[model samples]
Target: MKKLLSILSFGVIAFSCQQQTAEETNAPSVSEESLKAHIHVLSSDDFQGRKPFTEGEIKTVNYLADQFKSYGLEPGNGDSYSQEVPMVELTAMPSETMTISGGSEDVVLNVLDDFVAYTERVVEETSLNASELVFAGYGVVAPEYGWNDYEGLDVKGKTVIVLVNDPGFASGDSTFFKGETMTYYGRWTYKFEEAARQGAAGCLIIHETVPAGYPWLVVRNSWSGASLYLDQSGENFQPDVLGWITRDAAIRIFEASGQDMKNYGEMSRSVDFKPFSLGLNATVTVKNKIKRDQSKNVIAKITGTERPDEYVIYSAHWDHLGIGQEIDGDSIYNGAHDNASGTATMLGIAEAMSKMKTKPKRTVVFLAVTAEEQGLLGSKHYAQNPIYPPSQTVANINMDGITAWGPMKDLTVVGYGQSELEDIAEDVAQTQGRYIIPDPDPGKGYFFRSDHFQFAKVGIPALYASGSYEHMTKGVDYIDSLNQIYLNTQYHRPQDEYDPSYWTFDGMALDGNLLMEVGLRVANSEDWPAWKDGSEFKSIRENSMK
Candidate 1:
């Protein structure tokens, strides 16, 4: 494994700074006011939460393209600044009652409260009658880890209620499936996918705050709206019904089957665990209002001086939890910090590149994608079918939520140990007296949750660095507290609106510059970054680069 930069190399930081082309008149000053201006417009209430296939998306993409034009940047896709992403919007409305019958009495699970169900199959009425419920422990089937939660257990055409996260978390065994640091198997998406692979009719993950990393409220708000997915002509690669049930609901159902959920959770952590047949059977009926439309990905390019073909990408999702459930009587989700901040930062960096006196050797593309709140659909589409082919794309630096409390003393590199891009982040962070830290909670599997992961999937080394949690004014504890507050109160809620009083651009401003500098470093470099040891993407990168 590659060790960190030696302490003696700290003095070499100034030497590294000398290689930068910042002295050129073209190096544009990225200002806090400019960042605020972009955020104000994009996250404004007028944008209607920036939901795709709505007026919000139209306004968001147009404004982004217009800004790119005003900044004197060229269109990224063909001759147009916009690239259409055809999607099928499904507003699935479940029946009021989901009956789970087993013992003497039948339990009627409430929709949007107890569980949320969805089917990607393009059908008018997708209903399941008396689907047997199977408790499949963690619901993971990885041969590499000698794990198969469904080993010798047949769950085909059954509804499997599994615990969220992985065995390592429940058992607190570090050697078992990455221990606290969640592998991809710990991700909810992986659980659902594995169920589909096993031919399970339905999959419902039991939601626990510690393991899932968010309160059940977040699940309700996020899952209770119109969901957007890529319009595919082939077979839908998803379960007939995928859902999440509150921990309370899972416990009640298990108890009805005479199994203590408290002990059942403990049993899941063991490799010898077997599937429990919950005598309970599930009945589901879903009615969906489907709307087919095309959303645009706003693409703007600052072409390189030398290797115009080789590209460097800067990305940020422009979608949020859209106008959904009300909070304090406010329906607008504003998404000011969730992504409006990242979108603004992407724009600010692009603007800086536009004013540069010297263009780098590789082209830089700024992509503000749509339908991110729907599961990074926009970036996935771009990765699968690129206007700029993924092979030519050198690196992707994605900006998501940037800590806005104030100036920070450190930077947290998500997927920190996965690639050499962290080296670039570390080098730049040192110049500003800021240190580099890995994602504090890898068990959340945040590395796979963002747009950069899509790029990485296609063999491109991608960097997504979260803003420092350690603040200069209040210390790291205060910063962590603020993050928890955002998670509990503001995230994905109407309260996530912009407010200069409680937020600041001091730290975000520096972050934007760091993104720009990192991109410049890669764009101007002769060698491409390689995925580091222990990264699943390493072999893929090596093969693709070869």
Candidate 2:
């Protein structure tokens, strides 16, 4: 009996050793060296900041294709690695000043200073000539929340001035529109769309730094430059003009109308808040240089051995602000941390996947999308015209900005509780001696801001996360300070250039490994992650699967 027991124990020990060896051998090699090389090249001036519809686009796409080919990855699109995305470039030149009248006194807001406006219309010119202006609170119409800012208000042929965020942010009540966590209703994109649906001729949001999650400078720099949009073809509802006004500008306009801006802002926090006319008229014209063009979404994939029909996708936007308003005498917005890091990380994962000893059972695709800075147009186009059916596409793992601040004790998942993908991510994170946390600053609406949101809208469970906020060695405060510096100084600015001096990739490598393992688990298994019950995307996915 003792000899038999000894033999069984030996067998168990041998089996455990074999399993560990297999895991170690099959683990993807996501290296810091690879990540740094990709980021440095992509963010270099030679890429011209990787803007679409420019020489930068040509250089960037070709480089990505070359890298994928070098890694022995097959083209994702049939017979080609590039997917053409049709777009229209609109360089709107608004009038020097927006004039307000019919108030106690006329007030003129300077363009790019106190106000910034642009039009999505494809026409050469559009205008708001003395359009009646109404204050429409947050411009949100959520039936579930029983809040309707446009109720009983006819804004047709008029301009609606709304607040940037929703009432939940103002009230800080979790039951009210998800509290400080900004919902889609709080996003400026939603405000404009709602205004257009209400038949408003124009929509302007009042920008407050904290609620907006960015300063006036970011607004000016982003909106003032040439913008790109998916070729609308007159299919969508877009107001004649969409814009933003600084808080100071809003105050002046309100004062001219004999109303206190502070009081109105406080009142907007309530669900019963009603829309009212500001007794003012706005006049402005936007002349545009319209150019229709095509951008490329670089795609590469590895076909699964067992389940080639099912897919797992990885995405990162490869576009940035490009050459724009000069800041500190530098015009190139290198977007090193904005997206180059994320793109590099994706490439690292691709390299590791390509070198795997055993390929995943489900097809794995690497999608490097374009024009995300211009409101996620590349991803939007792909979602609308998908190569793989959304129902068959198992999941999308998106990487936006990757932290350079070394490894973290936790991974921050944007829109944390929305999907079962979070559960998978949590399991994978635990293997690395790390944990998962929801985004600390949900008021930024980051989940909707990135390319993953497009996939989510189409019912594909998407995961966007990074090792952030709690550095392994530096702690939380260190990460926060770095984030603040990046937000205040480098974000969307020319100063976003990569400097190897302080930038580190150990953390990025850790994140890449985590993402790779999660995707591998999904791709090799028969699981299709579903959205959580309370997620807004849950119904869309359920209906599609049916």
Candidate 3:
């Protein structure tokens, strides 16, 4: 009888082990209800459009925390599911006025119609009066590439105006700056940062709708609202005035400097390109008031079984254009595809993984960041002040503006040619009977604009994949038209609301599965993914790994 009891116990143990193994290998199926439910709640009117500082933020963050708790995810930040990202929300509304003087004749560039400007320095009172202006060519500093735009120039007490993209982008030459693919040097954020480092009182970027990827109206709409930034604790960070000037205004300035706008634009692409002081001068006067407020970055994590110290992070921004000035009587900019879908998808993935009978070998952090619409600020904060050390974090899987259309035959990696993450992505895609495709417009610079960039800057291999419209059920042409319509009319506007009828979430599930596979492969492996050869981030990752 004792022998019989032992045999039964052994049988039970074997069965349980097999079950656990199956659970670990099998992919979890996501539900439509799960996706819709989360997104609906997040984009609902009661959430007040999920703006960071308003009651909207409170409702949205609490909902995210409750959902994380329900999924059995551990609090990501020391017994708390939410990280209180202390931010000073500033709203600057300046009356339109800017004056410019140069040459024998004085030129005054009007605000709103000609240019847009704002200040990062939190001051009760500020003004820009007759500030000397310097034109910085493609405002970039890449020591590795032996390029410097501010060579031996003191920009203090002066306003620096910069061209839009990198030299390679402007030059249409592959050998110049990463070619059409924009380096971080091409990003507006980098331009502002370089100017700040140079002690420039203010920095202004020339805006071309094609290179900047949106119209000046889009810029105005975005900057008109409240801007959020991580509040500085000490005196190390210096804030400066940041703004943009229209292409026509830029052309006028170039003409005033006795240079043809077309010739200068072409000249900027050459390796011999040097920062020249545009003989024209620019002056602007601004008035603004500042207010301080706070926001939250909702975070949750599932600890690993073997390597809990190491992590895989999945992130999406949760905030969007909330309660914009009414356009055609529609006030709420319900950012359904802009990021509610991405945020909801992250939670869905978290829920699916958390329900598995066996835990992963590495921790998975689901981060729903704030103010990506404002300029990747929340991700910037998390990257600099990470909950887990960046070196231990394997990679960042980021989703921004996921497709609402149905399934397709391909996946689009924003920065396709940059790193080895594309290889892993392709391997996963093959399993789904899909393939990987590069962004059609490398010149558009979608890679630098997303939240994944923050992680990439800190030497983490990051993946920014979204659904493709090439083979949707409605046909490629229809799918393409739909996306173009969204881009033309709805992007960053009040019309970005949920449309249950047209938005087939079939691709959402597929995208989620691909993300799951990528994380699983990274989580279970002993190896770390690295950027490819000649990539700027490759050396950094190698050093961090060592």
Candidate 4:
């Protein structure tokens, strides 16, 4: 009887081991509880809005490194997990009012109310003293589109006022500069760069609610404080002033110049539009308090057992607007949804990957970039001075934000048709009984807004996607209404705090799982995803491979 009892106990123990092995063979599950916990800590006020060059930055980077170490990930950089990004912080205090002359009548515009401006030049003071003003249409110079708002026009020593978005947005013609979808030329940064290249003294973008995708208050809030820029080693060109003016203020300027603003706006929709002088002169001075410092991009990696040289990167920005002008008695821009959620999602994915029983074939990197709000500076630095060869880098999957409105039936891919990664994402979405969709509003230029754009420019296939639009229990309308509310009231404001009673994490978990599976497939496979034929990045990738 004793021998028989011993035999049964051994069989039971063997069977339990088999079951545990089977569970380990499958992908690890992403936990909503884990994600919520991470978001709660990162978005807390103690982080001080996670701004670079502050105590907030020190805490944020250290926390990320600690979390990665806990997940068993090795430091991505040799002997260190932080990549130092050199930057300059410029706090510009402009004149109280900009005075305009050489028009029908002199017009004075209030600083923050009617307009907001700043200088990227590393100088103590820069001024536009009676600089001639020109209306440069969209201020775009795209050779491929056969459009040049500054064609045969000299803007040297002058201030140019340009429209907010590209002409294709106004015409809605699919053949015209990518139709309603904004190209790189439509971005405000591109406009400023082009103006500086044209030797313009200053550039002011006219702000329209629909075209600019936000109210004037967003422009005021974002540009009013200290702004960060790449040190550039004094190589890049920057205008004396870069700014935005309210629609009302723009109208007054146009009226003073004896040109109907509405007529010029209509004419700008055509490719034949030409830049013309507004017959106005402007005067303003900016005093800058500049500080040069170093910020960090936190990185960690799970080295592949097989092809360790090739890599698949997952990236998210860890910086926000920081402490600013108080609103609603709350001075912290927690960036709960704007990016803390994304950083948490990356952490959740890293934990899952670290626990995988069967490791990936290619190295997987988790990168938390800095100064995305200041303009994708960390990623830009990495792209320019890559630790890994761009040609050997397999792909990049970026998360800017994750939905908190519960699970969704569809995943929206920004820059949907740019590469073959979307195809893989679609297949992964199907496994979860979800479909893939393109961004509903492409004119906002979201594809160019995030860190992924830096990778794309350097010839790597990158995917920026999330599960949004069609909720599981609530319909599409419900999701749309929530998005509107968030954008109008909370976006870029101090009120963008985490609220446990209102926020949910199931949706974030689902999206995180989908992204993890997509990345895992890429990491284990031998095939390198290629850019779609007409993609602007195709040539760049092709040349790099050669």
Candidate 2 or 3, higher lDDT?
Answer: 2
The stretch of ten residues in a row with the least summed lDDT in candidate 4 is 14-23
Number of backbone clashes in candidate 3:
0
lDDT of 1 by residue, 91-203 (tens): 88887878898767888899988988877777776877899999999999888899999988788899998988888885667788888788888888889899998889999
lDDT of 4: 0.90
- Candidate models: Cα lDDT each: 0.85, 0.91, 0.79, 0.90
Query: Over the stretch 473-494, how does candidate 3's per-residue lDDT look in tens digits?
Result: 3557877898888888888888
Q: Model 4, stretches more than 4 Å misplaced? A: 1-25
How would you encode candidate 2's per-residue C-alpha lDDT over 429-477 as one tens digit per residue? 7766678999999988888999999999999999999988898756799
Per-prediction TM-score, please? 0.95, 0.95, 0.91, 0.95
- Could you give candidate 4's per-residue lDDT for residues 50-114 as a string of tens digits? 99998889999999999999999999999799899999999989999999998767999999999
Clashes of each: 2, 0, 0, 0
Best candidate (score: lDDT): 2
**lDDT (Cα, 0-100) at 144 in candidate 4:** 84
List where candidate 3 sits over 4 angstroms from the true fold.
Answer: 1-24, 103-105, 233-239
Show the colliding residue pairs in model 1. Answer: 26-356, 26-357
